[model samples]
Target: MTIFQVTLKNCAFYAHHGVFEQEKALGQRFFVDVVMDVEAGDALGSDDIEQTVHYGLVYELVEKIMTGSRRNLIETLANDVALGLTAWSPMIRRVEVAIRKPSAPIAGILDYVEVRVEHRN
Candidate 1:
């Protein structure tokens, strides 16, 4: 299967995503990463926007997730986003999304909290 990749790296969003009540009440910044796999052959020759996944639409999809309501877990959010993106585009055979929280409420020091999800159609 030929593959085409679309990656949106280090996207920041202000949203409530935590289990604790205070955490939900006070929203924090979260990062998102998205990648998509598409059949490249069809668009390889023509170089037609119509034949491939439009990058603008991908951005819109991600924006929607960022602006949407609070979620308890990034895993669920990532999975839903990946599945939703693939479902919207016929050319996409699979999609992968990663959501990261840098300032998680953890006592221990860490760079970030992240979850990755993959979907295949």
Candidate 2:
């Protein structure tokens, strides 16, 4: 079994996702990274995209989730992305979803708050 990899990094979105009301109202920038291990099957050599997960579909899935609704936690966002990846394609064996909140409502100076979730078959 060959493990094929697909990664989407720095997928950015502006959305309302946070615990505080102001944070929800104002919205913020979020960066999402999705990595997957997939069974390439024939697509590895056949050059047929149908045998593997189409990354465009994956990006659309993430976009729908990131821009469509409001969530209070990046944890939930990460988990949802992981689950969605698996559900989107049976070829996916494992997935890791990372979400970075640049404008996290923290008092102190920091880079960002990130939440990551991993899921497997």
Candidate 3:
């Protein structure tokens, strides 16, 4: 038995998710990266879409989660994404979700604030 991985990276979404009142009101861009590990099984040989997890569906799920609600912490958001992806596909043995806040309200000059979360069956 072999394991395969599917990754969706740098998925950008603009939403209001933050602890600060100003952040909630102003909104900002968020980037999400997801990696899903699945048992290759027949999918590897068959080359069939049905045999493996659909990447588009995963993207849609991420988009829904990112735009759906507001959370104070990126950690919570990443956790939600991990859980959501795991639940979305039974074939997914493990899921890694990373959330990046580029315009986070910070005093010093920085690239971004990021949080990574993982979920496994």
Which digits, one per residue and each the tens of the lDDT, describe model 3 over residues 1-121? 7888999999999999999999999999999999989978789889999999989999999999999989999999999989988887889999999999999889999999999998998
What lDDT tens digits, residue by residue, belong to model 2 across residues 1-121? 8997899999999999999999888999999999999997999898987888999999999999898878998999888888888888889999999999988888999999999999997
Model 3: worst 10 consecutive residues (lDDT sum): 81-90
Stretches > 4 Å off in candidate 2: none
- Model 2 gets an lDDT of 0.91
Model 3, residue 68: displacement in angstroms?
0.2
User: Which candidate model has the greater lDDT, 2 or 3?
Assistant: 3
TM-score of each: 0.91, 0.97, 0.97
Off by over 4 Å in 1: none
Q: What C-alpha lDDT, on a 0 to 100 scale, does residue 57 get in candidate 2?
A: 92
Name the better of 1 and 3 by TM-score. 3
Compared with the true structure, the alpha-carbon lDDT of candidate 3 equals 0.92
* lDDT tens per residue, model 1, 1-115: 5787878888888888788887799888888888888878678789898888998888888878766867788888888788779888878888889999888889999999889
lDDT of 2 at 99: 98
With candidate 2 superimposed using the best TM-score fit, by how many Å does residue 44's alpha carbon deviate from the native? 0.9
